[model samples]
Target: MLPNTLAQEMPRALQHLLAREEQTDMTTLPRRSFLKLAGAGGLALGLYPSLASAQAPAAAGLKPFEQPTAFVQIAANGDVTVTINRLEFGQGVQTALPMILAEELDADWAKVRSKHGSNNPAYADPLFGMHLTGGSTAIKHSYTQYRELGARARAMLLTAAAARWNVDVKTLRTQAGWVLGSGGRKASYGELAEAAMSQPVPEKVTLKNPKDFRIIGKPTTRLDAKAKSSGRQNFGIDVQLPGQLTAVIARPPVFGAKIASLEDGAARAVPGVKTVLRVPLDRGAEGVAVVAEGYWQAKLGRDALKLQWDTSGVEKVDSEKQLAQYRELAGQAGPRHFDADMAPLANAPHTLEAEFVFPYLAHAPMEPLNCTVQIGDNGAELWVGSQMPGLDGMAAARVLGFKPEQIKVNVQTAGGGFGRRAIATSDYVVEACTIAKATRAAGFNVPVRTLWSREDDIKGGYYRPMHLHRARIGFNAQGQVLAWDHTLVGQSIISGTFFEGMMVKNGIDATAIEGMREPYPLPMRLTVHHPKQNVPVLWWRSVGSTHTAYVMETLIDEIARATKQDPVAYRMKLIGDKHPRHRAALQLAVEKSSYGKKALPQGRAWGVAVHESFSTVVAYVVEASVKEGKPVLHRVTAGVHCNLAVNPRTVEAQIQGAALMGLATCLPGAAITLKDGEVQQSNFGDYAVPRITDMPQITVHVVPSADAPTGMGEPGLPPLAPAFANAIARLTGKTPRELPFKLA
Candidate 1:
């Protein structure tokens, strides 16, 4: 984390973030309203539901938020339902969180079920106190909370069973959803459901030890696997209600650019078109929403509309021009992150000077962003795949002139989000509410489902900030770093958002300087320049690690090559046991991938990279080769040290998917370039994401640990590109500096 100057000047809640930020712990990501209470520390179990509402019964000996009825429900036929607090965006929380709870509850694996949670304060993250699913905190922060939730429920069930058997509560034990009492008396959890819920919820309960865990750490299939495979799973895009109108907006060409004129006669002429209304869009822009009976009609209506001619007010960002400006900024003296002595670099025996360019990247999730809003007389309900529903609910209230409680947000499953759906602006959700408000005001008493097509999401959404990194390193022939001069230039992803107060300070956004000079200590002087860009930007998957990992790893590999030492050994010696997780991960990957011990197939070479993000360490050793003038990754072996593997299957899938996305950056068409302030690539054909053919065979291995879980959703991503790049460097004598490799 970069040094901050505004620590004492910021709010008390924000001041509390400095200690966590200094440790680079992504798990403690905070929200505005939540930070104040979270700063006070010791959030009770299950969020103290009574504090959220007076409806929570003041039952005998059952404290607030300990209501077993909130999270668990047992049916008459012996089925258990567990409510997940976070949105399931294909990261497998739908199964993983349930597994954690079920493990403690001793529920039958075959009869367990999972359902999505809402914007209910009871479902807020136990640590951060917000309705969040990003930052890979779903399992990391809630692992123990879910366990306690299950244990508490089990305790109540035992108490009820004991009462029926006329035995002491301590004499009763649970086994596979059945409570066993003295004299061989037993009752299924479903059989005692009502009486059990009436019993007092426990204030605290002992959790199962790792040795006693029957379900956690096992490679369990997802609860939604069958539905997803059978195409029966319903995402937000698939939601429908009676008389629901579909709306698609015709946004301005550039960010914050407004419409000067409007001609919607042709749009209204489209069949099934209901109405066309000009509405306020994100970033102070205006858009015309074309409402129709269905998506097809709305698409036609949106495409039919024509009228535009106001561009003189906004900045027209060209990719080349922006790159030139970034390069200029990279060379200037700026705010320092690590200001280490650089005198040794002037006369080092060995040195490496390199520059890397990462283009603006769009989060092209399989299911493009969409939201459904049903506006009633005094209240509105939203059904969307929101990572931050609390913030979105507040934003919707503002758009509809309703109180926060009046707006109820039902979290929905998403096909994929990467990081787009977790925007601070609540851009998509607010836009949908605005559309529904417009429809209701125009005598069209109907709910509205606003869908962004692939084109719309790709061309008009926030992108990962394009970045430029320049590094000059000096080291001995033996590979001991003497000095490293590094500079990063990019637009701050959190600069204009609420996160800026916590994530940025002293004119330097720590997000831009993360993943530098650690794991392997090196004397370094790191500086950053955050230029204000017209394009909207947000965190993409692994965030700063996306580019930072690539730069740090490949450059380290280059040093090993120069020093004529084994890359693995060089890393191990530099590592020197300070970070056991990093060492364990790298060593595991080296052994599993058979680095230096096994022969490669013909032209294939071994590529190695290790990185820690979101407190989880993932090391990748790749088999790579250049084929037909393009880089090809044949196979990848990953070693992960996430502390615990709730579901090894989910861990494996996340790695495979993230590695594929990482490989996408190396493809020829991966860059989201702009010319004259307009996105050049609109759809999948031009904007290259890895297709099925591009997928490499990947195998995942986790370093067995009994420690608390870190984060797995994003750690698998950062190390992939660098491992692939290291192999490419070994294949081609030249190092590739820019993304979407342009070969000469």
Candidate 2:
């Protein structure tokens, strides 16, 4: 069942999405139509074999590098299929990416559909040289790659049409999937695909100018919106195969704990229970896998098992103790991120010292972690919603003792990931492969689907590390910051991962300090401390910006209030004229929201905040009031500057969704904590996520620009909480130092 957090879409939006998904029975188009063309002498673009090549070499093979020229396909029936190289996960890449390709192809928009690409080498991120999607880099990195692909395909079709009509290539123009030559010669891309595939691949192609773009910056609707709403879209969790068995694991209560004793009598007695096996789990924790005919039985079998765990030598983290230690660490600066003299603090006329605490956050994607693995003599096949398919596939090959080329990974659509689906260790994928390998060793050759129940998912680790921030600022009555000193303490997400070498330097993880004092050029000293902890940690949405932006923006607002200056005007002064994008975004929000001029309802006040993450700037003007001793956010108006919106509709949706998730951060029970090393919160019942009623009235507006687009998935989130807090502060006359506001 989908979480209420995700199902809170407006009635009309839900109707549209459900209607589309209901009409479509499956996620993928009928490959038969294109496969039937295999024996024909026609071109079949972007085709991947259903299985690993039978001719795979005994050792590592060049076959591992081969991929279908496989992004755009035109069928003889004039259907255009565009392949998206990254996971969708509700970010709209499935729609925006296809729009980019179809725009360059000049294909008829109505004839275009999209397909999710797997771990094939051709689908690797163009800039990163890996099959991964995170850091909001999908569109930023692939914008040109897809455009070039479409242009090349379009160029080939134009050449074919020109040859067919015996006209100069320059004299031919393409529009609406048709190549028109001089003297009124015209042919559909489908009719020319075969001949075009045989033409010499163009070494260079001219891209369409921004002025000529018809689809790039348009307010296009999402292609998969309907399917997702209708429940016809098959996310990774919805996959079912014949003879497939569901497997659930009974994990240790403590991280890195080993099983001392286990009793499987009750578990094996459960109806539909097939077999039980011991499996190697991630982080050196041992677990028992219960395989059954269905998920419910597997879950029941897991519940029935009695296992004794040995937690010796494992750190039992208590949240209260950790916070106390972090607070002590913050008082004493350790490593410096910025070198600035704070000598003026001693003599400054006015000063403020504040401490902020942020708890660990669960990504809690709508669909819990799931992976299906099937091992065969020739090769192994895996189906998953993998953000890094190549990485996961390689990990599977290593675990199964097969060559990389012998493993085939089929990437599936995901409900939502934030940052959970992409991991350097490929933790969940490896766990599934381990279970499958154990099942095979136990004499079961059937497909094994590893599923995580909502409890297992919430208790599972890899959360946003808890953070503490201490800031000391000295400013005059004019709001000019004379001195600033900041200290941050937290666990480093990249410390033990493969990316540690590149992402961590000088005792600082790059992601850990991304949104620190920037758009405002203030002379300040910033220091950090990274403590090793037993809990696993990963990036959550906006990464460090999640906490940093809140600290920076809220403190800035405090400075404005201290100086008796309008928050918006003070922010503009600090932003200066250097960052036009930030300035423009803030100004636009101010104007659209009528920040100073609009009359608010009695007891309501306006709040403002602006932040930039992943190169995208967003500003929010919000209205809030205190109702019955609780903060009530009534409405929000957002101004986004992602340069050119690939699909305005998608940008709007991302902001609205991200804002809600941001609001979730300020709601009661919106945190993950540990007691005796075990996760205390284990579902929506205890771990709060915003319901439909919690959502504020939102209006999203984008600054029109012809520049290249930036990321939208994360930028909208960083400003929401601070804007709400700023409004609440106006009424309470007190600063909010902790999350889930404790009003007095």
Candidate 3:
């Protein structure tokens, strides 16, 4: 439930718009007559002469700036406001989405303002049926709709200008918010604002061709770059509301443990401590929150408290033990399978089989998880950076025993999501709500803001589950690959109660079986999934593709080695020649990296890997050398096939960022585990991320196509790990089957 003030303010804000509309004389008038009347009304109301020039409305009485997904409003003072409904979580969506709309509207970019829209079905994505942003689908989903929106507004403005000047719209063109006629008569959009506002929306709007686009494909700087660089951009951790108290929780030491009792004598005596309460942990997890005036005080209070935990069930859970169990499971023949064949090879052929292991990983976002909740008599108000607002709203409503409408979720910019922010049950948000409710029950009227320390966040169990993959491939004497058999042992991403009804036939989780079932043209390819139930796992950056791509690409390298053929040539042979983009990326990466030319000094070698994910094809040529028993990356040359980039600069940045992130993860970073199911690595001092000194010189090449824009965020990540592993194998003459590859 949201605070009464915010809940009460919403209807008033909506009613204000309705009242403003009712004040206008909106009786049915012909399109032409409506514009003339609006222009006359503007002139009579003492509007600037620049705003009194325009013609009539379009058919159906549609307004110029109205859009199904977003709306644009132009004020009399030349302020152009564009509303975006999608969440911007370090993906540059705040800048990119508006660029599409502003390019079509021909609005002055310098004067444009971006605002986030409320959660409504009007803003729902047509493909997903929800107003959500994930799976790298932001730009791809809104590309066409935003363009149409901008084009419609442009047409209406042009129509209004033609009517005012008694000239044909065909002879007029718009640029920088001004409409210009054949003879050089020019009128600013503000001059034609009222008449344009009265114009009807176009039934069929044509989009600009690629060559004619001045802004869509250009490399414009990110709109929020300045704010972010100047430390003014507010993420979830930076949110602070009036009279908001801070809170910190003490969680159990083991998974699924229960809290026995708490000795809060020291916590209650801590300075600035407001309240210490033992709240029931959601989802059967253990924790107690300590509320205080500030985060430091809350932390001190939480640390001072003594608590006992009952770790009866999960005391023996260990990663090494889990890995051994998974290996045992992978050895068994499974009935629930997709595209897999585990039988012995039939014809005269060469076969290669190996098992790969990937450890569990944590998201470890920079800002950590934080949320501010204020519950009042009317409803509940929550200020947080949530990836799934609807889901968060429902969860808050359920905990507070109120209707979903009673909760108001104020979405904020996230430091980084990477699927961590979409936790079905937000522990931070729920804790804050509970604190607020507890305070209200105590007659204190104080809201609570829960903040999870970096340690707390790292210890949470929303990790990318450890996976075991066993694979075998057979190649004929002609060097043609004939059969592929793969079995994956990992936790099901969609098996939990939250996703109870989303399971497909035989309870197969598509996320866990992503890259295992490729669409390649193979003679006999079989993939099987053996779901592991004990460990808790969730989606990470690339989801299943993260490990699956590594396994598949590494297996291909092994096949190429056995066939005694060039790796690039072998992959090119297997892939379809008709896929020009895929072939082009492969060719470019190989040619640029001098794939088969020569080996570098110091026993260095280069390895090539190509993969397609998120509708984008990418190829990587990684150069590596074993120096003093350590794999040192020298250079990485990549070719990216992202169809029709909305912003080429953003696409390049995303590729560069993804490559660095993948390199960091590939080098050495997994959530280290203890024998009692507790995380050992808790902070950056122990958990390493890629630094400037460790970065290799990276070259990214984009293969352009006029095809629709595909995903750019995760596609660049899938190739790095496998490419590096193949390079390591070539250098050491041993297959690097496990992640966090260590050289001997």
Candidate 4:
């Protein structure tokens, strides 16, 4: 079955090549037939090259190079369709990836449309050879791959035009979907599509110089902007197939708790309720599913169900108790990430010790989790806003007792993910598949759409791990660091996962200590403790950088103030020109924000912080004030150094959105707390995310560079909180020791 599917997966270019290879006498073929079927005429939808791994070596009776069938497609109407390998969860890859391919194809941008890809092996990440969209790597990894695809497609079209015009291909150039020949003879790509199918796929082509770029690096609007703005864009939550049933699960209130007994008499009596059954949940837990005709009915049935839970062995994590445990752990050193002698701390001229606490945070994507699963005799199909479709598909296969290839996972456009959609556990997908399997067992032949209400999503186990940082610093009178010892205590997000082998070493998770003691030459000793907690924790937006950056930047500012030196100037001196990117980004923000040149309004202070995460450096200079004992961030000026911004508009939007989320950390009710082993906050009423009223006046500036672009999505967030803290500290003359600063 897999072998037959592999053959069907070949792209049009490879199909034509394979057909030519089978011909014994080429001269016997008709001339018109050669012209029509030689290249890509009538290229079937599934005719693109097979997965890169499936395309064996030339010695293995397969092509030496994989073809570009999965990514690029040209319709008869001249609409250029480019398939994005990454999920478009508000990061603008739908527009940016198309821009990359269209720029090289010389296709009319106005005619370009983007599509989200599925779990095809061909859509795997170029670097990891897996389906993923996290670490902000969508653009960074696929930039060259997409460009080459466009170039290859354009070369084929040009060859066809040259043949039709009876001229050398070298004399033809493409522009805006047209091939121009000498003496103004031109042909639209649509007119040459049938003949161009015969052109050989080029293994190598010259990429355009940055100076010659007409589309990339320009500020282009998002391709899905109109559809999304007009409320026509279909998200995973919006998927409604025929004969589909809605499912709502009633999970245990305590993490890892199981249902001991159930009473579903009233639930089954509901008007549209179909059946109620127990199912397996993530992390060895159990849940009850309420299947019905629609979401509202399923939800009502779920609310009507009565059950008894057994949480005897489960750990009931209390936020206050957890903080006490962390403080005790911080007092003793754990495994060391960096080693330095602490002898200087005993007799240092100036010393400061501070402990910072950060609580768990929910991803709270605008669209709560949902997965639509359709089961048939031969296989099953899944539709979800998946960041890791390959993993999700495999999980579904396991749940349904089918082969991995038997399940098709369709990645859908999402409202926002941050880092929740991409999980090591594939929890949501598995839950959906479980419900589907149970529905089938109950003799229901309809598709099952599992939906998570906002309350369920917020209370879900996977969250950004709560963290505690203890820093003991000793510095000279001039703000020169003498010795720094830092201890971090948090649950290991990758300790027992599949990524542990690669991401964890020496009992320390690299993600737990990513942004420590860099860009500044501090003789620092860093220690980390990974406590096994019942709570499920995953990487947040910027991972460890979220808290590490805040701790480092705020402490540095405090040391500068103690020594009576300008904060920005002290930062420059410590930076010492080793990291030019950090320096440039910081300088740009200071210059653009007029940090020292202009006087701020009374009661307002300028706060500055800079940090690098995901290979991008971001600096924020903000105006903040303490109004009635609450910190209010008035305005923000950001200098971003993500190298070349593929689309400045996307970059700006990302920075603005990320900055707003960062401000959310400073607002009152931002932290997720656990009481008696249950998530205390279930919805926005208690878990406060930033509203439009909390937004500040923001200006984002990009440093001009031709260097390859890094990630922009997560970098903007890590600095905003620290910058705001620095401003509030100036007004109160006291440092903030925890998130959502407590001022009395």
Q: Quote the lDDT for 99 in model 3.
A: 84
Ranking by TM-score: 1, 4, 2, 3
lDDT of 3 by residue, 1-744 (tens): 223322222211001111111221111223443344233221011111111224344456433223422366777766677777577777777878888888888878887777665443334443333345666767776787677778888898899999999988999998888888987799887788778878776857888887777778888888888989999988878877788788888988776788877899999899988888777665577678788999999999998989998877654467778788888887776646455343545553788778888877878888898888888777787888877665566567767777666677777888886888766556566767776787667566877888889988787767887788887677776566666666788876656534333333365565666665343565444444555544456778877788878887887788788777788888877776656777888888887877778667767788788877766788999898777787778899988888888888888788777877777766766445556577777887766777797788888888878876877777788889889889888878887888777665
**What lDDT, from 0 to 1, does candidate 4 have?**
0.84
Model 2 TM-score relative to the real fold = 0.91
**How does each model score on lDDT?**
0.84, 0.83, 0.71, 0.84
lDDT of each residue in 539-638, candidate 2, tens digit only: 8998888898899999999999999999999999999998898999998999999988978999999989999888789999999998899888899999
Q: How do the residues 1-744 of candidate 1 rate in per-residue lDDT, one tens digit apiece? A: 322422321221112233334432223333444454333331212232233322323356542224556788889878999988889999999999999999999999899999987777667775555677877778987887788889988888888888888778888888998988777788999998888877766666898989999999999999999999999999999999999999999998888888899999999999999999999999888899999999999999988898795888889999999999999999999999889999999999998999999999999999999999998888888999998887788788788988677778888999899889888789999899999999889889988999999999999858999999999999998999999999999998877676666668788876666677767788989989999888999888888888999999999999999999888899999999788989999999999988898889999988999998877889999999998888889999999999889999999998888888888988889989999999998999999988899899999999999888877788888899889888988889777888877655
CA deviation > 4 Å runs, candidate 4:
1-66
Question: How close is each model in CA RMSD to the real structure?
Answer: 4.1, 9.8, 10.6, 9.4
Put down candidate 4 lDDT per residue, 237-258, tens digits, no spaces: 9999998999999999999999
Where is model 1 more than 4 Å wrong at Cα?
A: 1-67
Backbone clash pairs in model 4 (N, Cα, C under 3 Å; residues 3+ apart or in different chains), count: 11
Off by over 4 Å in 3: 1-69, 159-172, 182-185, 190-199, 313-316, 339-348, 497-503, 517-519, 523-534, 597-599
